[model samples]
Target: MKITVLIENTKGELEDLINEHGLSLYIEKGNKRILFDTGKTNNFIVNAQKLGINLENIDVVVLSHGHADHGGGLLSFLKINNRAKIYMKRKVFGDYYSGNILFKKSIGINKEVFEKYSSRIEYIDNFTEIMEDVFIITDIQRNHKVPEGNKYLFVKEGTKIVNDKFEHELIMVIKENKGICMFSGCSHNGAVNMIEAVNKLFPGTSIKALIGGFHLAKIPAIDIFSTSQDEIDLIINKIVNEKIEKVYTGHCTGEKAYNKLKQGLGNKIEYIRTGSEVQI
Candidate 1:
């Protein structure tokens, strides 16, 4: 499998690539060409062009959650790619927000985009294999504590704005001959819980790689960690115990949190940014 960082929070070695406060990965597995996310803007489209990637030929597009940073490029993607099927959770159109009582901002996708491209969008509410070897899992078990940063995220229910339960978030698992590679947008459900959930679903299968943000950092700000040292340590312990071969993280994972994880996991963990590429 080959994964190319179409867009990410930080700039990488390539000076020409664009960076933003979002995440997007172009994945090529066998004959399948998949786009993990579209970042927060059309910058992903620009970066793809520079990277010699042809978005028009992409076979599938997966929006990992309802957050704007993850799905903001949907409009641009729909305008360019006419044939790829897009998959997301059923409730991903809910009003999602960030911040506390003092202030809040809309962090969800624009409903107009969904309405415009309704025919190409697939709303998934359960575990489904979109194709052979490609699976989407939404029933994430809450076996561990959710992200501390999640407290600031909210979803509208009736007339009340309540804490988001993250039911709209989903994990993508791609099965290969050696093992499986899991892709998460931002682990608001908790990385440890996600790992355990995948383990339970696919029994003795070894996880070769785990990619995407862990939600261990505060949003709307940088250089701030939302989780405590103890929580970070616990998460590191779980990754080590699970024997996950590699973890590629960035975006909301926070620089401090990523460094802390690096100290614990050593060369097992890597920070991915725009223009980065990985082969597994």
Candidate 2:
């Protein structure tokens, strides 16, 4: 399997591509080419063009969750590839907040965009299959230790608090003879929780690797409320318990948290900069 990062939060000094706080991973396994998320904006298109990625060749499009950073590039993606089937949660759109700022978000294909490619978009309310080897885990029901995720997150029906459990956040499992390669957007459902869910769904399967945002950057600050080193240790320990061999994390994963994870995971973690590629 080939996983190429089309957009990320950082880039190498020699790379001229502009940096953005978003995530977009392009996966190619066998005959399938899948686009995980669209990054924060049209910069994804610019970066893809720079990398010579033919977006039109993508066979499937999957939205990890309903945050703008992950789902924002859909309009541009749809413009290029109108035939790819889309897999997303049922209640995709929602209103969210990054601290004080409000963000209008959507998970699945945008309603307006979907109208144009309704036939190709496949909305997954529960679990669904894209191919014989690729399966999407859509049933997300996990709680977090901190009240950080989806606090201001909700759906809109003319004006209502649509409880969004982040069901739109699906885990993509690519079957390999060794195990499964897990691809996630933000894992708003908690990275460890998502892994546990995946393990339960597919018994005895081990995660070969994890790629995408873990959203650990939003871990509450100690100054405002109260946090302890032990809590951080606990979180890190849980991640280690998953037995994930490697991790490529960035996007909303703040520098402080990333550093902590780096310290904990050490050699097992590889920082994913924009335009980077990993083969497994």
Candidate 3:
């Protein structure tokens, strides 16, 4: 499988490529062409063209969650790629917001885009195999610590704005010859839990790699991470114990947290930036 970073929070060595506070990966597995998350805007589309990635040829588009940074490019994608089926979890259109009661900002996808492309969008509420070896798992176990940053994320329930449970998040697993590669958007459900969920679903299958943001950064303010040092250590410990071969993380995973993880995981971890590419 070949994965190309279409857009990310940081720029790559290529000067032409642009970066944003989002994530998007162009994946090619066998005959299947998958686009995971579209970053926060049409910038991903622009970056894809520079990387020689034809978005029109995408066979499938998966929105990691309701967050705008991940699915905000839906309208642009729909305008360019009409044949590809877009998949997202149920309730992904909920009014997702970030910040405390004093201040909040909309962080969810544009409902207008969803309404316009409703025909092309498929809602997956349970474990589903969208293709032969490509699977989407929504039953993420919450046995481990969720992102500390999640406390600030809210979803509107009736007239009350409550803490987001992140039921709209899903994990993508692709079975490869070596093992399975997992793709997550922000991992609001927690990376450790995602690993365990995949392990339980596919017993005895080795997890070759995990890609995407771990949501370990401080929200509203990115200068410092919201996750405590102990929590970061615990997460690192869990990833090491799971024996995941490689972990490509960035975007919501703060720089400090990444460094901490790097110290623990050594060369097993890498920081993914725009124009980054990985082959598994």
lDDT of candidates 1 onward, in order = 0.92, 0.72, 0.89
TM-score order, best first, reads: 1, 3, 2
Which residue window of length 10 is worst by lDDT in model 3? 218-227
Clashes of 1: 0
Count of steric clashes across candidates, in order: 0, 1, 0
By TM-score, the better pick of 1 and 3 is 1
Residue-level lDDT of model 3, residues 122-210, one tens digit each, is 99989999998999999998998899889889999999999999999999999998789999998999988988999999998899999
Model 2, span 52-82: residue lDDT tens = 8889899988888777777778887888886
Deviation (Å) of 140 in candidate 3:
1.1
Better of 1 and 2 by TM-score: 1
Ranking by lDDT: 1, 3, 2
Model 3 CA lDDT for position 280: 91
- Ranked by lDDT, the better of candidates 1 and 3 is 1
lDDT of 2 at 167: 55
